[model samples]
Each structure stands twice: as structure tokens, then as C-alpha cells.
Target: MTVKVFLATATVALGLMAVPAFAEEAPAPAVTPANAAAPPSAADLLFEQPQMRNAAPGSTITYDYLRRSGIAKGPFGAPLQDTVTLKVEKPTVAEKGGAGTPSADARDIAVTMFSGLNRVPAGPFEDMTGNPIVSLFFENHLRALAKVLEANPRYLKLAIRRGLRERAAVTPVKVKVGDREVDGWQVVTRPFAGDPMTERMRGLDDLTYTVVTSPAVPGEIVSMEAASRSKDGGELLQEKLNYDPKAG
Candidate 1:
């Protein structure tokens, strides 16, 4: 199916978050295709020093977000605010799938998310929940960041297949988190070449996602933001990273 169709299906599927619980497994890391005509060099794929993978198991990053629906400011509206914590865990085994090679030594880290004090399950949805769209958004965002940090080109292709792209330009940006000001690269990825409706349905028009990574630590995503608006151009969702500190 086309990326637009896949994104629409994804949004619908995400609406049901209360799916059946199954055994949790480590997420697979991205890898390059063996038969590609041309491939990136090891240096091109490797993350610089102080990578996200270097974080100790207990390190945590927190973000604060707000969701609003309906008119920007009027009756029949739904607005909510919450916090999500991403905790780093020890390396785990990588999932199967990739160039027929054993993934034995591949780096697979487990990063779990918590909404308030409730643990969010890993993997796709199976049932309905309150705000599955937002949850799934963060999950995919972080997972994609993880793969990119590991220098996997396949991850970019996977994102394209899922309706995201790698054509976004990297721009210099400054962001404030808590009391500190961070200088990083703002990488924005849009849908593949297509009609505007596809972009809108995928929330690309309503929301602009920017991944911020410090140049000092190339692949580490220091912060991210999603600014969204309603169909009628009203405010909808606001998500921003609040704090990210190394585990002491």
C-alpha cells in the first residue's frame, strides 16, 4: 500500500491501545542492506561520542505535553496535559530480521516509557485506550531516533515505507529545556512526494515534528517537539521535552 494509506491505517490502529499483552521483546536495530548499489561508510553510520547508547541503564528523559481537540477556544473541546518518562535499560538481544546474518552482537537497548506512574506497553496496539495516537507517536519517534543513532540506513527506508522521509534538511537550532539552553540540529522529516491531503491525514500539516540532536553528541536526540493544529486550523497538540540528564 502507499505511505498515505499505511499512515491512515496506523492512526486508526493506534486509537486502540488496550491491546492484549504479550511477552515484551527488545526492539530490532536498523541495519544496511547488503545488496545496495552504494552504501554509507562506517563513519557515516556511527554516532559520535556520548551517544544515547552510552547512557547507563537508569538514565531518564522526561517530557511534558498538552493535547487539545475541537475549536481552539470554545465549547465541545477536549484538552489534557501529561508527562512521559523514557528510561534507559541495559542492552538486550536484537529481534530477528535483516541480511541473513546472526544479530548476536548487535546492540539492542530497552527504553521504556511511563505515562505518569503507569508503564506503557511496547509494540503495536490490540485494543482501545484513551489517547493511543499520542502514545504511538512518541514510541515511533523514539524508536526511529534509536535506530538512526545506531547508524542504520534501513531505518530511514523503513520510515519512508511508513510514510516518513529522510529528505528533511538539518538546520541549526537552539532549544530551552528547564533552565538550560541547548544548541542542536533540527531535523524535520516530511511524507514522501505526494498530495497535501495525505500529509494532512498523517497530521503532517497539523503537526510539525522536529528532532533535536546536539552536535557534540551526533546521534543523541536531546529533545523533540510536535506542534499540531485541528482540522479547522485550531490548536491541537503540543509536546516538548522538559528535561534530560545523565544518571548519576
Candidate 2:
């Protein structure tokens, strides 16, 4: 099945106004894979931010579910009409709590979604009330890549450094979405001599197939979509998050 991935934008609004920044105040910390640990689970990735917990009491958050149908080009890329539910809630402070702090409450506002491939009983298997679990596999792979890049800067051995140095330098790849380009790293495994040589015999490069994309930016995709000579089919999977200012 061949699945061509694309995104359409949607906006949801909460009544809260954006606060102006003060010049002297320190800048908001950069959210990088190195600083931010891999989310423990899919649920932890979605609504576990301080901002979500700090929404004013009584404010409601809205979600829009999208189901799209398109031609798939992969082993399992059958015509898929998938429905994804986005649950949005604005966290509010319960008045009964003795803490007088304005936003001390730690309630979570999240959007949970399940894919057609998911067969778990829905409760203890994976939390469906929190983050969308559809994208967990991609997140884990990207983080693993980042760890490799940071630890080993020289990824592939250049001809110049072959015998002179015993180390292989790892190169970092730039990840971009919209106008923001994330700079970090991941470790990809290269194939060794004992690996399958059929592709190599045909003059095709033989490389071990594992890549980690670190800092797992939202909207970044790690799927392959290309034309092949063989008629063999495959499965296609894609998920996207489109954000915009709340509708007027």
C-alpha cells in the first residue's frame, strides 16, 4: 500500500488571552530531546505540560476529530477511512482544594486517539484519556537517534580519517517543520559485512535499516514513500497535528 501523507490545518480557541512578555525575564527554556526525556508512554507525551495544567478554572477546551480517505501504497495500505478523535479539555482548579494558589491544581487537559491497528481493551492497556497513542512508535525512534548523535559526533568514517584515527565521526541531520528547524542527532545502524549481500551484488548499497530521529518534533514524519517496480503491497500509517489560532 502506498500512503501519501499530508496535513490540513484546523484551529480551536480558548477564552484565555496571551500574556505579554517582560524583557528582563529569562527566556522560556528550549524544549530539546537532551533536556526533555522521552515521554514515558504515549499518554505522557500529549497533555503533561505545565501550560495545559494552568488553564483558568471553568474555561473549556475544544477538539475536532478528522477522518480522511485516500489511496494507500504499502503492504497494508488498503483504502483507509480512519477516524481520529481529538479530546480537548481546559484544566480548572477545584475550589475545595485548600491551596490558595491561583493555578496550583494539577488536572490534565488532553486529546486521546486510537488507530485502527490498535486492538487493546482500551483501559489499562494504554491510557486513552491522555495523549494520542497513534504516534508513539515514531517518537521513540526519533529519541533513540538523538542519543546516538550526541554521544558520537563522527557518524560515518571519511576517507581522510580512515587509518589516521580510530574513531568514526557521526554527522547530525537537520529536522525541519514549518519555519522551525531542530538541530540534534540520532544513531542509525550501518550494515556490516555478514549482512545480506544480494542487494550489494546488484550494485545497490547495503545499509542496516535503523534510524532514530531525536527531539521528536511534532509534524516530522519518518515513513518511506516511493515508487517501486514490484507489485508487492504494503501498509501505510500517518498522523498529524495541525494547530492555529482559535476561530473567531
Best by TM-score: 1
Model 1 lDDT on a 0 to 1 scale? 0.37
How many backbone clashes are present in model 2?
28
- Across 134-187, the per-residue lDDT of candidate 1 in tens digits comes to 334455443433332332333333443343333454555555533555554555
TM-score of 1: 0.46
- lDDT winner: 1
- TM-score for candidate 2, please give it: 0.26
Candidate 1: how many backbone clashes?
A: 3
